[model samples]
Target: MDLPIETTRLRLTELTLTDLADYENLIMIPEISVGAGFNLVSNPKMLGAVARRQVTAPNSFGIRVKGRLVGAILLHEQVGFDYQPDHANLELSYFLHPDWWHQGIMSEALIKLIEELTASKTIKTLNAEVFSSNQASKGVLKKAGFQKKTTLIDPLVSKEKVIYQRALR
Candidate 1:
């Protein structure tokens, strides 16, 4: 709903070309890349292209700490769910640099984003699917008021995933 939402220790802003280098570095980390369903990119040009697309992608935000890019959050159309045609729903996906893990920074950023999106009244629901093995992400979602809706094997990644959902209204 708004660009550059701020929390106590982080800034959530629209991704830009200027963030390309940091984005590339963060996205290349194996733990983050693989966990987020991204194929490892070795070619610099292809990496740059992906970074550029992320910059231009709608509802994508760069998670910055102290003016440095450390993570990202993306909201897109939610699939595999049935709902009234008029209801607006989106799926959430996020990844953070390993150095920032377990710091509660992600929970903080996610809470703020949820607040802004709910306040805008444009979103009726939000959903996130986390690998069942990713307890940290599950904790983050639970802390942000999401509830487990279902569990299934994610075809794209072939991993068991737990779907969490939060209703705004």
Candidate 2:
């Protein structure tokens, strides 16, 4: 799959197997994973598995800075979700390098991605599960026009998460 998404100073592409090392390092960062659904680096094979899965998944994109893969922005199609009964929504997720913090690169990539995906008519609305402590991501979603749809307790993580929604139109 040839995934390429461009922003003023960043690119959002697809994840690859080579990302395991970086993903491992990133997972170890406390700030990056706080309230994140996954814990610290304990599964490299799982990361590889996800990369393989994303190669065929239409909605997942790897965010890049200066042509280097830095993070990922993901989406789960509405059809297979347990929340299918809720008026057509796809779940969104993102992660970035701690080095990229406060650079506005994510905000740029996010807005561009939302615009491109919506313009392509791939999805009508976007939703996100934001961990309460991950304020950086929460702000990105809000700036990208996502509004709080609801809050739910993630059974797996046992944490309060916010469900944010945004209409493409």
Candidate 3:
């Protein structure tokens, strides 16, 4: 919920209504959608709707590189979905522009985010689901200290979804 979650070469901040254009461009890329699950952008109206919803969602952050919106991250509380009494299970999701892929920027950003969130003690667990074919995302989560828990066959995508979890304590 804070603005400008600063990393060495990037800034993570909340998405705003004006960021729709950048968000649209980022998610519409074929490669980006493949990993980020951007089916919500199949049509213009749906794209607009998803973009608008992103800006209003709680704990969604736009990742910026040198003042340009190049990616986005989200932390969602999974209420009643595998609930643990003492720990809040928050889902972590992120996407970076294809052009910025393999540059280590995303890994750095994620490490910084985990540090901040853990220090705050607001979230007790961080969870992520990555398509089995998404090697980069799998690597990012591992580098951020998340352990692979299990794999589920996602019917919609017809691919294995690797579930990763990191306890924030």
Query: Among these predicted structures, which one has the highest TM-score?
Result: 3
Name the lDDT value of residue 3 in candidate 3: 62
For model 2, the run of ten residues with the poorest summed lDDT? 80-89
Clashing residue pairs in candidate 3, if any?
Answer: none
lDDT tens per residue, model 3, 122-141: 78899999998888889999
What lDDT does model 1 reach?
Answer: 0.88
Candidate 1 matches the true fold with a TM-score of 0.88
Ordered list by lDDT, greatest first: 1, 3, 2
Q: What does candidate 1's lDDT look like per residue over 18-109, in tens digits?
A: 88778888877899878875665667788778778877788889999999899999887755445434337888899999999999999999
Worst 10 residues of 1 by lDDT: 78-87
The lDDT leader among the candidates is 1
Q: Choose 1 or 2, whichever is better by TM-score.
A: 1
TM-scores for all predictions:
0.88, 0.79, 0.91
Candidate RMSDs in Å, in order, are 2.8, 3.5, 2.4
* Tens-digit lDDT string for candidate 2 (70-158): 77787776664564543346777777887898888888888988878777764678878887766887898889998998888878778
Instruction: Tell me how many clashing residue pairs each candidate has.
Output: 0, 1, 0
